[model samples]
Target: MTAKYPNKEHVTYATFLSSNRREKVDGVEIGTQFTKVVVNHPLQENEELVRPMKHCKTIGDVHSEGTSIAWPSICIQKING
Candidate 1:
């Protein structure tokens, strides 16, 4: 994604899945889940000094291939002395 400023300068962003949980994807009676995204800071021209601005992106903007859940097995074991 690219964002343009007043001067028409564009910024490129490379987003990744910093962290996530099952709850975010689906409400399975689990705890709340959050997704964190990081962007590559680029140099921007100002009056004199160049500063790196923080990029803000919504969670919905993220794209995923798919998701799967691994349920734990429940069984009883028998022991003999």
Candidate 2:
């Protein structure tokens, strides 16, 4: 591997969703994964997204590990308690 990438530090990797393999017992999968350091913005045609953005909200909106940010795009009603 060193021969192919002697200076790997110079490599600027973009969002890639190739860490996990596509495996489905019945072809139904959903939810988000905060474990990935790099998340593919525009999912490819042949790629499978195990996690969906909608499910993330129900799970505390954890887009990534060690970080938590409010989803401003959602229409949240401000009800005074």
Candidate 3:
């Protein structure tokens, strides 16, 4: 997928499934399964810093307008072992 910035700069992202498995059923209980994926060349700090305004492109302007915005990208990703 390609992400286009407000300045018209495009960034390509490639995702790969590192590992995946089906859930196994034990007796009458059902187990949960998950897939582990890795995104090649994920965005870095420098990239964000260089384009801080790019981050706000989606929400447009928010100058004390009392408008609520949802920024899913800002959510933190948790790693499990």
Candidate 4:
């Protein structure tokens, strides 16, 4: 898909709901934890496949990774504490 924000980066939400071809004692198959971010909005058919989002909260590890500014002290405290 193409869009105005083709270069803008963001995260999308997806879930592994079911597996059709798998043999288990309980007849259940575990799915994947992989989530892919789409540069453009997902198609109509992919709407139910994943939940898309524009943003998410930053975590505390950002500072430990050697970044000058992760977030404000108060913001980090509010999130981490």
Per-model root-mean-square deviation over C-alphas: 19.5, 16.6, 14.9, 17.3
Query: Per-model C-alpha lDDT, please?
Result: 0.25, 0.24, 0.26, 0.21
The CA-based lDDT of model 3 is what?
0.26
Report clashes for each candidate as comma-separated counts: 0, 2, 0, 0
**33-57: candidate 1 lDDT, tens digit per residue:** 3232333333332211111212212
Clashing pairs in 1: none
- Mark the regions of model 4 whose C-alpha exceeds 4 Å error after superposition: 1-32, 39-41, 49-81
**Where is the poorest 10-residue window by lDDT in model 1?**
69-78
Q: What digit string (tens of lDDT, one per residue) describes model 3 on residues 3-29?
A: 322343333222323222332211111
| Candidate number of the best TM-score | 1
* CA deviation > 4 Å runs, candidate 1: 4-9, 18-36, 43-81
Candidate 1 local distance difference test against the native: 0.25
Stretches of candidate 3 exceeding 4 Å from the true structure? 1-14, 22-33, 45-81
Give per-residue CA lDDT, model 2, range 1-81, as digits (tens).
Answer: 001122222111123222232322123221232222232122222222233343342222232322222211111122244
Preferred candidate (TM-score higher): 3 or 4: 3
Window of ten residues with lowest summed lDDT in model 4: 70-79
Give me the overall lDDT of model 4. Answer: 0.21
Q: What C-alpha lDDT, on a 0 to 100 scale, does residue 52 get in candidate 2? A: 34
